[model samples]
Target: MEELEAELAQLSGKLELARESLKRLRITRETVTEVLAEMEPEMPVVAVDAGPPRSGERVVSAYAGAERRVIGVLTVPNWQPGMMPDVLPSAYRDIVEVVADAPGPIRAKQIVPRIGLPAETGKIEGTRAKLKRLVERGWLDEEAPGLWACSPSSTACSGSCCG
Candidate 1:
């Protein structure tokens, strides 16, 4: 009986070691995912296969660090020749400007001070709201939770010789 008890103790130690190894692996995975997201200049586009022909192009809408890549075809409505906003609202413009200037995704808190808003004034909520709306409008992409980055199209507009 004493021998069996000793063996059980050894197995428990091995089990604990395996769990620690798994935790390290998970952390590594998350870090790699964030790095990849930062490297991407625009949202990753993937070829999707589904349904009949659609008017607009199919786009990949998966968030960064997804455990299993969820591939789905999203048919853009309207399919307008030029859908870019001619003029963005002041607040929206400011937020997009910051995102465009950033080397990678910028968190809401980081943007607050840059935009001249007090970080402790609870005005960060306003920034977050605009970000979410911009993301929905395809002007920006949430590279990670609470991390904002400009879409490729928005960045292109900055270099235009529009006078």
Candidate 2:
């Protein structure tokens, strides 16, 4: 009986320690999230009345008997001859401009800080995702794995980075 009581006490102590550790971790996570939210710029919100539209489709809303097209802030439209970086979301435009201004190919990590984002892993990966999307849409080129540069055909790069 005494041995069982000692073991139970040990388990209780361990349980308390685990609870305390979990509480501390939760608090740390909350604080870090708050700090990050404050540090990051406010992203523009797009209100779509209907379900999410297919990529490259413009959202139209009828207001006062007139239809107005709304550009999605997160959409990356495929590049065309006359399409300019102005059509991209501000974040994407920033990345393109950074790449266009660079002397050669750059990595997401290098672009992150240049575009005013923290050089954290999450930021770098998010930037990499945008970079890949731009490549897919012909706004940028991937010379090799993880290396990004302005696409030669892109109007944003024609006279600047690619030249």
Candidate 3:
């Protein structure tokens, strides 16, 4: 009974430490988010598909009172007809290409090394987040839990890559 009591005390102490660490992490995340919000440029609402620029053309936006071309915003856009992978940033385009070339549904771990990222937990999780974003934007498909594949409607998948 004494040994059990001692073990319970130790477990309680460890739990307290874990709770504190989690609180610190949450606070850090909130602080970083606030900082980023302050640093981001205010973008004007531009109508998409104005018919002046051709499909896949980079959109220009005002940044710091200077006009700058925005190639890829953080959020992925829904895949549209005539849209190409070129519109995505290099990293996202690489992911699409990798998924398009894959023989079947792939896991983030399998995609990490193929995309030249080290097979680390952070890299894998980051890639997984991108995969989820792609799926959310209709650029990719999640066939099963943690298994990602190219969306059938995506030009990347329907193009020569599928052949």
Candidate 4:
């Protein structure tokens, strides 16, 4: 029992050190973003493949450190709504497409206008809802509140988008 307790204590100390390191590294959003741009101006892009989920394949989406719980059928490029009954909610699908096609981590403000409103992508309210939900679901990350981008470990997601 003493041995087990000692081992657990050592593990806890390591975890604390890792967490402290994170706190030290976290910085103002603006500064980190500028550094990223200076390092690589051309933002990377992510592509989702079209097919049924396969065993042990990465989760529908992955993020910072968690496997995004696959709550719905994932989306992929070239997916026509008619092809799958579970195509991503309309506006989100459009938003995803726009983000995927963009040269970089397009600002939400920029994309919403180009995709238009209350049509194929649905009303502004609907689009925003999808954006929020997708971010929560880990398909996207809240880079700057309203701004979003695919995560690093993302399976159907990728890129170094920040805004």
Q: Model 4 Cα displacement at 162 (Å)?
A: 17
Using lDDT as the yardstick, the better of models 2 and 4 is 2
Q: Could you give the candidate ranking by lDDT, starting with the highest?
A: 2, 3, 1, 4
Task: For each candidate in the order shown, give its overall lDDT on alpha carbons.
Answer: 0.61, 0.75, 0.73, 0.51
Best by TM-score: 3
Candidate 3, residues 1-163: lDDT per residue as tens digits? 9999999999999999999998897676556444444543432222233335444334344333433333223545678877677666678888998988889999999999999999999999999999998998889999999999988888868876445
lDDT of 2 at 151: 87
Model 4 C-alpha lDDT per residue in residues 1-163, reported as the tens digit of each score: 9999999999999999999886665443335434433542122212234455445333433223333323332333232212221235555656766765666565665676768753444455556676677666555566776666664444334432222
**Cα lDDT tens digits for candidate 1, 1-163:** 9999999999999999999998897677556545543544333423233544334322233434333322332222111234433345456667777777787889998998888899964789878987888888677789889999766555322443121
Least well predicted 10-residue stretch by lDDT in candidate 1: 70-79
Best by lDDT: 2
Error of 1 at 68 (Å): 45
Q: Sorted by TM-score, highest first, which candidate order results?
A: 3, 2, 1, 4
In candidate 2 the C-alpha lDDT for residue 90 amounts to 89
> What lDDT would candidate 1 get against the real structure?
0.61
Clashing pairs in 2: none
Give per-model TM-scores. 0.44, 0.55, 0.56, 0.37
TM-score-best of 1 and 4: 1
RMSD of 2: 11.3
